[model samples]
Target: MNRSNTTALTQPGAPMKVRNVSKRFGAFTALDDVSLDVAAGELVCLLGPSGCGKTTLLRCIAGLERQDSGVLYLGDRDVSDLAPQARDYGILFQSYALFPNLSVEANIAYGLAGSNRDVVRKRVGEMLDLVGLSGSEKKFPGQLSGGQQQRVALARALAPAPSLLLLDEPMSALDARVREHLCTELRQLQRQLGITTLMVTHNQDEAMLMADRIAVMNNGKVEQYATPQDIYDKPATPFVAEFVGQGNWLPFQRSSDSHANVGGMSMRLAAGAGQAASGRLFCRPEAISVNPLLHEENLFPARVREITFLGNRCRMSFELNQLPGHALTAEVGSQDLPRLGAQDIFVALPPESLQVFA
Candidate 1:
């Protein structure tokens, strides 16, 4: 949680801008002309798979690592060459990085080292309240749960009331259930306080759930940067489309900018799609309709290869007769399964639902 009702810890957020930044270590490139604009009070996630350079970019912004080239800005200030201690932002690492020997009070007050003792105590109390850990100030990191330790780290990061907040895999240490709850809480608090934040995460769900926008990275370069819905629905690259979520991909030859041929089956594509050439047609499983009556002409015979029930929903795996050997999955509500009892069915993949990448 990043919000605060106490004026002592609340401050207006500052925008962050990274302009044509690049970093490299030896022969390995870590960031490639990366650029991003994070508006004031917005949460942006640097999302990608492991070793994709998301962390490296975060480190460069935090001044933990020096960038080989390019500029960085926090609001109107150029902080490209500033060291970590001199930067006007607080970072929470994946490890929590809390001092095991220090009490929660001390850990959170570490950032206020030179402040008056009374002021430090008041700020620590305000931070503890902000994170919903008010009464646990005397507890050591080892004496608290994983989630609590994370809050202490968060409180420490926010204690300085920095205009920009940086998060590096902040919830990776918690169990799934706790991570989910804390994420929601943290997001609410971040919005409540209106703090600008940059988060680095490999988990797609976390990024999708909390980010106002996301920068999808791969191989030390930004693949696509946009809102989660835009990134998911209109991915700019094959890497972005494949990395963001589960989808059915089939090799096909484009008939034109608006049509594609998968095997002998004709599939409509988005207008102004890829060039007329061989490419892959992509569609998310959730976008596929199972035997819709309205799209009868586009429907194809399919056999249910498997059906997995997941509480409120079901994931149906299908083998389309027209595109055999291609993986096809459709996610439907559990209550809607009564109509899908038959092993055989007709499936529809609307033209507007597909992405063609040549």
Candidate 2:
């Protein structure tokens, strides 16, 4: 359904919807039955591994790439086949895509087509200031640093005040230092303007830090779309659970009741035991605790395999001799890390924290 006709889609007050959209390059499928929604003024980030059709989907929405089937709606307009310029959306690419000959001010003013000279000047000035690039308007693209050039690109995109903003890995081109600083600044700017924006990023940290909601895609399909917390906590599938965070799967033999023999350690299933299969148990690194006091239940013996010291925490891998083929990882506070080498460690695997899947 197109919301454009009801006067609600573009309301700045309304939402944007992407219907069952699919794109194929001859027999190769780039996007398969993808659909999602963004509330008015909401920021949604599309995240996935490379070649997962994220860019194709973003391009389709921007009118830069057409889909084989399904409709595209912006605020209430059916813009499935509209030209990129006609769609009235602003885009920022990974490379910044700034015109080398254009001065900072001109680059920003490029999108303000035919507005009065005074009006154009005012908008450009406002955007430059908003993006913290106030005095460098006359500098050409080559004169500015990479970060400054990016700010210019951003200023240009926002200058038009397009209802919808599309960003394709906008930070991938920047150095690490600039990328971190810009990520916060970009998010702040988006919130301040209240523009409904969609960004495509392969960096999980970027997605988690910037988006109000994230749509995790894989193999040309959206595996999950949810709040960053939900996507990390209650992943809908094994792929999602394994992909979103660090985890390990242990083999188990199913018992008559809900219990399973996880390796030689018979671990109890928390509630939905009946639904689990006999083969594997999903254990998140953070879910397992290595506290000194061991609880009577869920505690197991394991030898210390290796320990890597990370600034805030230490990552220790525990090798279970009972489960020869599997290993468990745990993150312990640097101060709480147990001395290893000669000492054996007894770890507690809370039943509630373990997820058993086929």
Candidate 3:
């Protein structure tokens, strides 16, 4: 809906806190002492692989699944024991949970059943307009495409103007192109509404694109909670580094606090490298330059075993001459491939870009 007309949807958001929440189903622990803070008007993403407790956590916050322990607070109020109906939040599931028999307008107006007719009508219209589905009010869920149905579900969730929004893999069913487009639209709308939001998704690209911060979860525990850039560039754990982006790991012997021997070469590492004598050295694929124009500290003679083009970039399999049996991958700009020849090719690992973990 247009901001000028929908006053209720513009209400300021509230903070949400999940404090030491834990849940278990028989022998499986879905959430193990999980906790996080969602600031007022902030968007946080619960990012992880399937069965990582992200969805379980979202359900707990929505009161659909009660935690076995801990408390939940919404805007300084204890909402731990409240029922789902009493929680001032709206949720949209992956399935887009619309009644096949109901029209789009009816679905959007479902939450306002007890409200006056005029109020419900106005709210439904505003929601449909806000989601860019203004003219499809009469269409049934069966008649709408997957993307359209997703927008309808979004409109339904916002109809009540809830203070918080919980989305569980909302765009997972859509095609890549549609998912990308809707991610932009949904993020813009959420910001405009100023609603605190938590979204669960296995897609790193979506989380990075939409969330102000991401909580990377693994095996029912939070591995890292930070901004998207921080999660990618300064991962707190090995699971986070491997999950959030593409990287290469090398088993190496630690020579000093800032040095390691990897791929049969002595390499300089960034400060804060772990102290373990033997550890794994991690470097993002993009950080490794093949035949770099600038001088590098850990440069070595390397051979390209394979080159796979991926539009703007090329993924090249690399093997250092000193470590012929070992392989590493380097991502270089496609346009720069012409500058290299069949000889003198080198792989440069910038010290400041390398991370060591035991």
Candidate 4:
């Protein structure tokens, strides 16, 4: 494939807008008043647990399933009523969905059926090269490894250069090591082509690594939509805080707009944490410092009940002396393991690391 000819197959991605979209399967509501927008050239992940309506929403946007009520727009064009073929998008599925009988080149060229023969051949070769499958063109899907087959599927999906790309757990079938490598490659390719992409995944780590923004969904509604860091560091809801990452929820009593008491130890609160009289204080295990100095404001005594070595870090579970039944988990670096002696230790919960939700 000629490098200069690649331009003919590439198009700038278009922004996608979904307004108040809802879908129902008889008595069950699949999507409920869902609304979101993806900027041109941006990649967003519709992340959630199973049966959360993420795949349904992706199907709706792809025109495979119609919403009960709502509008869908691609750039300035309303595509809600358009057919799948008319929506100007390409999709890669979890199963790789390749034709067993077709060769890699033929599969990639499948969507280019009516194009000029030479042009189709050129586009196929270009796609193969783009996906790092240049030498495997003649091999059928059955002869390729799982990762290679997925690459072929991805190449086929991008062969048409659609303005939008939809991925339904595209890397879920590959092994962990392959999935991680392909994920990085896919992100690089998406950026290079600048395709407005929406991916559906139940994996939090995958979404964090790939998406520019994440629309976290649950039970037919988007729980939160934000950048990965914000979603993890400053979750909009308790569910978002718990689901997006690992954290401990401890009971706390609000003292004022900027202070709280946890297990009788006074600690500063985040600005808006005092809205509730009492609530659960969410703190990531990694946020707590084990055996900090006694001068720390939120320092508390705890007996190390169990310690688990996790490579570079050690995970320790502590039974808080102030609250016997309650326990907090802390991740201490391997270098600090010796500092945590055989007795009770001091744990500090910094105010900035605490998120309170009523």
Report the C-alpha lDDT of model 4 over 1-358, residue by residue, as the tens digit: 2233444456999999999999999999999999999999999999999999999999999999989999999999999999999999989999989999999999999988899999999888889878777888899999999999988998889888899999999988889999999898889778878889999999999999999999999999999999999999889888788788888998889877888877787778766543777989889999998888456657778898899999999999888898887877999898899878985888888888988888
Per-residue lDDT tens digits for candidate 1, residues 51-71, read 889999999999999999999
TM-score list, all predictions: 0.95, 0.92, 0.96, 0.96
Off by over 4 Å in 4: 1-9
**Model 3 RMSD, rounded to 1 decimal:** 1.5
- In order, candidate lDDTs are 0.89, 0.81, 0.89, 0.89
lDDT for position 29 in model 4? 97
Model 2 worst lDDT run, 10 consecutive residues: 1-10
Model 3: ten consecutive residues of lowest lDDT? 1-10
Name every residue pair that clashes in candidate 4. none
Q: List the residue pairs that clash in candidate 2.
A: 3-76, 4-76, 9-75, 10-75
Candidate 3 lDDT over 43-96, as tens digits, reads 999999999999999999999999999999999989999999889998899999
**Cand. 4 Cα-lDDT:** 0.89
